[model samples]
Target: MSTANRDLALKKIELVPGKRVRQKSKLLQYIWFNRYLYLMLAPAVIYYLIFHYAPMYGAVVAFKDFSITKGILGSDWAGFKHFEYLFSQDKFWQVIQNTIIISVYRLIFGFPAPIIVALLLNEVRARLFKRTVQTVIYLPHFISWVILGGILINLLSTDNGVINNIIKAFGGTPIGFMSDETYFRGTLVFSMIWKEFGWNTIIYMAALAGIPPQLYEAAVIDGASRWQRLLHVTIPLIRSTIILILILRLGGIMEAGFEQIFVLYHPGVYSVADIIDTYVYRIGLTEGRFSIAAAVGLFKSAINFALLVLANRLARLMGEQGVY
Candidate 1:
């Protein structure tokens, strides 16, 4: 086309509506045209609506004197009585401290473990050996915490257990790992790493697979050693994936593995092992403090939401993609 004709065509395009408005109109048209496709999505939509969103109405009970006889709507308003009760209890602060400490320990030790494993696996040349290692490591993740808890109890037993037997062989006293408060938190952290590190590596391995081979080849040609290539080329490529996963981990700081703690913990280690979810279970179901438990749960959800938003904002500020 001639230059004048091209200029005229550009002018005509410029006279059209803004891109955002046009995009929305096109999306509506496409959705209407392929309404059957959306019909296929109805089951998932309905599932979330029914199971996830519909129950949110019960959250109002957190601010009420919730009674089995009185429905949520019919319950008398108690303002923040439950919340005030929760904040005043010393046990509540202890549970909060335990939760934060355990989460921080997991973030420190558990987070980098999978990344290290994935990097080492990437270096392995023997496919059979690599697959065998991966299979063995991943097996623990599929085992339920209830079963694993029993296994741990047996293994860490002070009498006639494998670890205690070894300790006796070395002339050291048998340690009550599960029962003693001193060792209980360490046991929790180690158990978590053993159970979930392999499963977590799957994500890092996938990210590693997407790193271009050309970068490694170029690094090699530039006289980079194996370690140099890994440090300079591989790490930088997966940096964004690491940052994204870290942000997600931060958002879950309030939830410190309820099932594992519940299964492994006893009255002996309650000082170190009690956390928010376990406390909620004890107060809500066992003690029948429904309103107080609901208030605590609501507080937990609010904190999680705030952390998620803060992490997303930080990611954007650091020039990475946010979850939003």
Candidate 2:
């Protein structure tokens, strides 16, 4: 309470121990031991530093009237003009709603798909079959969304498309999956799951591999069945990994597959399918509303950063290792 007492309390607090000469020497020794490996990683580190970290400097454009003629340095300061306009736009809220709906749907339906696939793969007795299935599923993840979108367009096209053909054969009405507002979101969510679920499963399978056989042995000895052992031991052990992934997902709350939306979206479904990233593209590049786009991007990034911090804090409170 008193200034002197406060000063004394501060003085009493110990500083964190720094790396001493011995520790420094040990670190150097370890580094030198794997010098070649470090050398291999150097280019990637430098690339990220130059390309990723350096570009963050250009975020200043959000506060300026960025002009090709003036350049970033000579651009006129606009203060918070873009930000104010961004909030005033009614479509901004619509884009945000679309982003949230798509992202939340993906989280609900797409997130667990890989986990289920991994579990099923783990249960398979035949290694060859499991590997084959994994390979087939993972192959889709490598295909570019541009190509996949084309395929989806043809397959879901209203006029004699594969899906429509099947629907007609079943005496059902042909639905325009891509252009229809009702089905557009569902199609996007399902297509994303189909594309990435297998690749996502790899991480969960790796985590499953680290699970000790001894736990299962103990469970079996205690008269636990396979399902019970899975429920108790396997799920519980991988719970932290799942939570960590969920927290990381929360960090990207505003990002709802830019590539997917850019490729799949059409004018008819734009109301429901247009997300923040797509809106930014149209405004910034197409409409030449550079500052407005920058403002929207900044807002998205700020919310993502805030969500990341909150999610990390929640993870820590739940006794899990957070990204921080």
Candidate 3:
């Protein structure tokens, strides 16, 4: 309000580093205080830089007529030729359809499962039973898809599997779940949820723990039922986390589980399960259509990048936190 005070404030503003310098200093201080944690994260950062980022340079093959001996740098550039080839194929649309359908199924069924489980677990009074149930559910997540796919094949095998045994006892024919295009995608999605929901619940459970206990106590005092408390208080508290995870999950829409699909699929179900990654593998390694495979890979990455950016923007617009 006074001239001297206004001049003093202006001088302080002039002395203050641009926003970037102050932010960098703050980040540096935080990092200094958490040096050990940063050191632990270094391996993952390096892994991504080497395996994920460095290989991005080879994306140029999407425009090149790649040759084995020529390598990426020496490959002859043929701009958009592979992309044209990809777009001309009927299987391209089929792959896109399968990818979208499977991802949508996962999002619809898999997303809310952990939240529901976490909410139920949060309300449990008995710690021993809780621990046992959590352990049982989470154990499957550690198993590789290779082993899981094998177990699925055995379970769904038409000859003498457990599911078929039940079908026979009921006077019905046993279906080859893995081989049926109609059933294969559904089976994979459900199995993925079964194997993953428990591990995913760990994050939701941790978020649930951070919600203030006083809210639940207040809800009880207000004569709210258990379900009412969960719906009104618990869900609201963890809504941001749910939104964040949903955005991140949607960003991977182009990437249906490669390992699971590859192992579970046969020629019979290839129409439904042949996703971008497996297609790339067949072309690049098996067929030696290196440039075409690289093109497909690049296309997949572009779509994923677009989705990530769009989701991040939508998340911000909706007042939710994003991975950025």
**CA lDDT scores, all candidates in order:** 0.93, 0.92, 0.88
lDDT of 1 by residue, 164-185 (tens): 8899999999998987899999
Clashing pairs in 2: none
TM-score of 3: 0.90
Best by TM-score: 2
Q: What does candidate 2's lDDT look like per residue over 199-283, in tens digits?
A: 9999999999999999989999999998998899989999999988999899998999999999999788989999999999999
Query: lDDT ranking from best to worst?
Result: 1, 2, 3
Which regions of candidate 3 deviate over 4 angstroms?
1-34
The runs of at least 3 residues in candidate 1 whose Cα sits more than 4 Å from the true structure, single-residue gaps closed, are 1-25, 32-47
State TM-scores per candidate: 0.89, 0.91, 0.90
Q: How would you encode candidate 3's per-residue C-alpha lDDT over 1-324 as one tens digit per residue? A: 999999999988987777769999999999999999999999999999999999888888789888879888888889988899899999877888888888889899998999889988888989999999999999999999989988987899889789998999999998878777778888989999999999999999999999998998999999999889888998888988998898889889998888888888877887888888888889899999988898888888788889999998998898887878
Q: What's the CA RMSD for each of the models? A: 5.7, 4.7, 4.0
Higher-scoring candidate on lDDT, 1 or 3: 1
| Better structure of 1 and 2 per lDDT | 1
